[model samples]
Target: MKKTCVHLMLLVVVFCLTTIVQNRAFSELDEGLGKSLKQDSVDVWEDFLNTLDRRGLSDPHWELESEDKEKLINYFKAKIAASVSEGLTSLPERLPSYVHRFPEGMLQTLKSHAENVLKVNPHNGAAAKFLAVEAFHKVNTQISSEKYPLLEKAMVLAPNDIEICFFAYAACTRLGDQTREEALVALERMLERLRGGDHKVSYLWTVRLYTSEVAATPVQIYLKINKKHPIIDRWEVVLTEILAVFENELLQTPDSGVFNIIAYIYEAVGDIAAAQAVFKNLKPFYEKRLAENPKDRTALTSLANIHNKLGNTDLAHEYSVKVNPTLAWEGQVLPEFSPVVDLDGKPVSLADYRGELVLLDFWATWCGPCIVEMPNVKAVYEKYRDQGFEIIGISLDTDEAALRKFIKENQLPWRQVFDGKRWEGPLAQQYGVRSIPAQFLIDREGRVISVKARGKRLNALVEAEIGDTID
Candidate 1:
């Protein structure tokens, strides 16, 4: 089984148990239905019961009562959870491959279960939330008309539910005026409840996850399409509330992982100063922890990460070296290389690009995200090529013909290195590239500067490095 599938199943199991156990909502089993459910081919109900065993509901015939509306809500929750587990087990690893690749059978099964829940209790917000999420994931761009109303309804019915509110908020950003307004109102309602410490809502971790994903959407869209989303102003309202909430949380529980979350949010919104301040504030806490325990792994790791982001490279390396002796630090000289040739059988050397700002882009023809990122990278390259800015394309493509065709068709003007070894290519190994679309921006002095210089940030970094007249 795929690792993603396993992890997702574990998370779903944990989340479902947490919900049911915390709510303490169990019902007597209906004998005929329970027997039929157990005899069902997939045994989802049996798995859910097995999962329920740890909560001391281990009776063989025990199952949720489907007739009771309140119990039915929890019952459907477990049903949806079981369906997801089944789907993950049976489906491909790439869930984000979206509609074209998503199994039609699984989608219909989930849709049917969600619809059944609504039939049992039309007011069941969880069912509405599930359908909204299903619709949100099934499309490529915007939420369709068929899905939008469901999403809007979920927002109205489950305003306190993080997933529902988040999907509704995201969908609204892609929609028209009235719907956007409705989503904003719903988000504000949730924010107010969160501020008031409403127990109906899930706590910090889940809210933080939703906030992080929402914060990242605009950045990801900008990176892919090279356009600031049309609803950015609306996003600002949401971000401001997020910042306020996290800031308040930090004041309540200082020196927590919430610090990292706040810093990430600031960075996502391009508030560099605010982000660095959060990191700087967090530094002393980890530093003091490291001082107390010289070999504290958590402290060492956190300090290293924080210092790296703070541009204190020497400090970052000092902490990182103590943790992992062989780890390379940012701002060190780019690693020396074995002889390699570009796609045209021409020799390629990093040393040749010395005294020029260069971006080493690790990408491949088969990677969808890598292709999505091309337009932004290409635009940055064209804008800065005359001012000592260059990009060395490190193509992790096993098929040289496909790579060549893509390059030629895209009219990419940069030199490209390819060994047709895919992820095992020497250039990728030298940089410890584990993921496609990995990028490193190196300075004129041949020192590694930024590893995540992509999207609009790519243009900004290149322009800052080489687009200005040097004294």
Candidate 2:
């Protein structure tokens, strides 16, 4: 499947992309008094079901009967009725207007339509998922006893659906009971399907699908709830299954997809020793690929990334030049810019710090995550200031007063540059920075060691760059 289709599928799973109630259409449907609403609701039904069909919600491996199609459309009528009665869409902007209580009338309509679909086609995963999402959302984000059955039914109906499996696992994580086992089972099943060759999707695709904000929130909730559980061990098993597939695939084909997924899985699991070993073993495969087809962009980029991760900075840069030298990575020289005045009107330039390890921190005073990370940044600075470590804060804040006030109150000693353009500031645009709290760790030679040094990782990268030990 294409990446765009995968994204749309994610939106559909989270109930955010479609199902907007056209006020006129819904009003007309409402006036019909239930049974007569059917004709007026077909447009709404088509809007919902067509979106699902386009987004790959149904199993492409299975064919739908004519009767099943009718039942599926009816199933969406429940969803439409619920959406209309609640006076809300699942769009992010409409979330503030959410209604907590499921109206008795709305519930009755949903139940009737759901029963209509399930009685005909009990394996209707989409209907089961709709019921599950509604049940979870209606109770003010609370876990209800009623939700478990719907989630289980959804899993049973669509064991191979990654979205449904995610929902099932996510819902299961909320409870403090044996549901943890079920949650793992759901995730394991998802991994099994991805690796079984039944679906043409890759493990990396599954990883990307879950990385989105909407999809990740539930997993975050799971982590928070299961703090005492052996989170790493259980998840490591699921990830290992994916690696097994990659390992087997590599024996036959030196595919970049398989190699990249293997690299990501190792890094995600935090097995640095294993990651080093795997990347080392996989290096020759990419080298041979490039040797045969020197213009293979995928191999060139992958080889550069592998070398960078393995701390082979020189080799990383050599391969990176073959791909795109402008792309920042370990051993790539920091992009040069003319000397610019700092917040205190002192002239500053990266060239001035060519022999000093520096951190180019792009952040704003108004950014919440940046604010939260200030103390940690301060700690790193205080520990390394005398040992040749420096931080250049590129403030992406348009508010000069707030920026200065935060700097003064916090007693931050670093030089800051502000252009009053927020994200449009020159330094930010120069580096293609799209988000804040982004830090680029520069070595003493003015080479970027890492572009994502933040939080606890900041301390590690700074230490590695400056070659210093902090007590």
Candidate 3:
């Protein structure tokens, strides 16, 4: 009986001790987990701050070494993983706020993180929206395909996000898949959301949506090709709404950018009378500025450009002279330059093309207008090659492969200068070339005949100059 009692006590003690050990193990694990979550959040926030600091200094990710870029991406990836592991539902909502802070090099990693979020929580609308944005950026960079489906999914999930609707509209327009009615619906929704809000933000979004080169070019091309199409009627309606918004905002605050955009929208939709009225309004504001500060170069240049566009040539010339007495206006001698090398490592220069009527062409492969005008340029080149006509193509293409492919495919015979820097190229800055498809018509004596000739005007100018030599 004594042995039985001792054995029973030993068994009870062993059971109690085992239970305590297991409980202690679980407590330690819980503490470790909490510490890990805190540490991950700290690390991610630190990385976010570092990223902002780098971007604030204008440090481009492409300039970073591969290892450094990989480290940054890994940081983001680890943060995302930690968020998922912790079951943090707010992460989807928070992650997008950091998207634009990172460079383009982190796009793929971001996309992956978004995908993982969606995998864990299929209803994560914010994650879906971010993925769509990433896809749009990729498309802009020519690195991805259409993301309309992803956008559509995001819209279905988050039906009230007007920003998502705007992006969806942009995606559809870029894909050339949305009809006039569909596009109008998206625009109306965007306008509805924007109504009675901060006018500056509204104006900024309006400019982004309707006035950018990417958004405007296709619409302009379509209207040019199909003047009487039913879509034009719908476009007219949308433009009227957009104008009303701008006019209402202008009534509250007379901003110069808003005024200029109002005129631009009017001109785009073929409303010359309204456009003239808007420009007519601009003169008083500019005159007031000039009266206050006579030598305000910015105001002087704005007037000169606006007048030039309005075909008030004498006023334009007057302002141009005020801005710079020795400006390289038409009928003036172009600034002299030494030789610059061509893409083939051959030394060629504007001086080399002296004694010939040269077309100093500043363009880029990515420029929609430049691409649209290339065939005409090619035809003129082929026809006028035998004459004393020359064309010097100063390409602002950043992609070497794309530039080389375009030149080879088009069989461009002109001498091209390509330094793989878009607007910051040396010659482009020297001549003050701000926009693409810019042309300078230089006579045989290297005198500037026209500084902004383009399209049909360029064709006419070139033909007139080379006509005598042709026959």
Candidate 4:
């Protein structure tokens, strides 16, 4: 019995010693981790301060002394080198604060930081996300071959990040000639992730995706006919896949926006029967809302527009009357505008072209539809300039350089109003120009003749009105 008691005493002594050793080790490890976290926090603050100082020098009015500039540059270089040497593992955590302080001019630095992190740890998802955003920014500025490999790498590293996946899909779609299959794969992955209940997929991103896919279908068809592009050889199959995805999305939530997109996609792909069916399905929803409230402008306008598109002109006219009873139709005199200066500091006003028919064209260089219609406008101007036809272009372009370049390249001889405030320029606001490529035709008496004149319709209207004077 004494021997057994002695054995139990030895076992208790050993257990106590082991427990004490473990407790000491854990306390030391906890201290070390706390120190590391504290150090990281300090580094993050330093990075933010440096970023702020760098940005402060970016102001056009703020001129930095050569010595100060050199010092700042060297400081940043040293910091970046240190971060790279340390593998930049903590950079992802610090990046958000740094970016919030200085959002501009940090792309290259962030790209380098992410690359360094990936070199150290290939599975760094946050680093991969930064790289993906950098690539997206690059591609949006202009299509390039550099964005794809980075996007592919990001997808492989962070397969579940919705933003990364969406960006990859965007890059693929933008450069669709070579990346159609990749786009499909990225889109599929995005949808799959969305289905997994990740609410991180934003509403705007979803809408953009739907619009891009639908828009690409028409472009692909055009390319196939014009260029015989083999990239879209299996466009029908790809379009079917896109339709399936849209149907699945609609099933999840019967959104009017999604329904509209699906209908457009169907029309673009030449599925008229399916398009009509979808439109018919949407008719009841709008009608139900209108029945609840007859004066709902949104419902009234939607019904009018859809019916007009479907050639139900009687129904369209009925809804249109309900929406606007006064009929501010063509031939009504438009509001007069005071004098505004053109880009070259020349004063212009509606009265300047009183003796001639005028076209007040509200447009912006950045607007896609406006750019697409510009050639037609130029052609019309050239054809009718000798017939006392004048154009007064009101540009909503904020970038002065781009506007000037576009005008010079296209040789747009018409006077332009450019105050550098997009959408809020004096003429744009005065004319209630909420959208671009807004056209208004003025008769020789300065009375508005047609407000919706565009393309061949504009050509016909001009020819009809000015045909008598053409001799």
- On lDDT, the candidate that comes out on top is 3
Q: After superposition, how far is residue 212 of candidate 2 from its true place, in Å?
A: 3.3
User: Relative to the unseen true structure, what is the C-alpha lDDT of residue 456 in candidate 4, on a scale of 0 to 100?
Assistant: 88
Off by over 4 Å in 2: 1-42, 45-131, 134-150, 153-163, 170-180, 188-259, 262-301, 307-313, 319-340, 346-372, 379-392, 396-414, 419-453, 459-471
Clashing pairs in 1: none
Kindly report which residue stretches of model 1 are placed more than 4 angstroms away from their true locations once superposed. 1-184, 191-201, 204-255, 262-338, 343-345, 349-369, 375-391, 395-414, 418-453, 457-471
> For residue 352, what is the lDDT in candidate 1?
94
Q: Cα deviation in Å at residue 225, candidate 2?
A: 18
- Model 2 Cα lDDT, one tens digit per residue, 1-471: 699999988978656423454344445445543433344444433333344445343443534444434443343464433432222222112111121222345546665766666676575555565566666553333455646788777666655555556656655555544465666777776676566564335644354434432233223434444445666567667667757766776776766666666766776766778878878878888889999999897788889888999999988878876665334555688778645679889888898888888988888988999999889999999988888999999999988999999999999999999889887777776776767788888888878887778888999888876677756
Judge candidate 1 against the unseen true structure and give its global Cα lDDT, from 0 to 1. 0.65
**Which run of 10 residues does model 3 get worst, by summed lDDT?**
81-90
Task: Quantify all predictions' global Cα lDDT against the true fold.
Answer: 0.65, 0.65, 0.68, 0.66
Candidates in order, TM-scores: namely 0.49, 0.47, 0.57, 0.53
Residue 286 lDDT in candidate 3: 89
Q: Residue 257's C-alpha lDDT in candidate 3?
A: 74
Model 1 lDDT tens row, 122-174: 76565666677677663434445556778777656654544455555665545
| lDDT per residue (tens digit) for residues 200-307 in model 3 | 767666666654423433235335536676666766666776777778779988888778878877887778888888888898898899999999887898799789
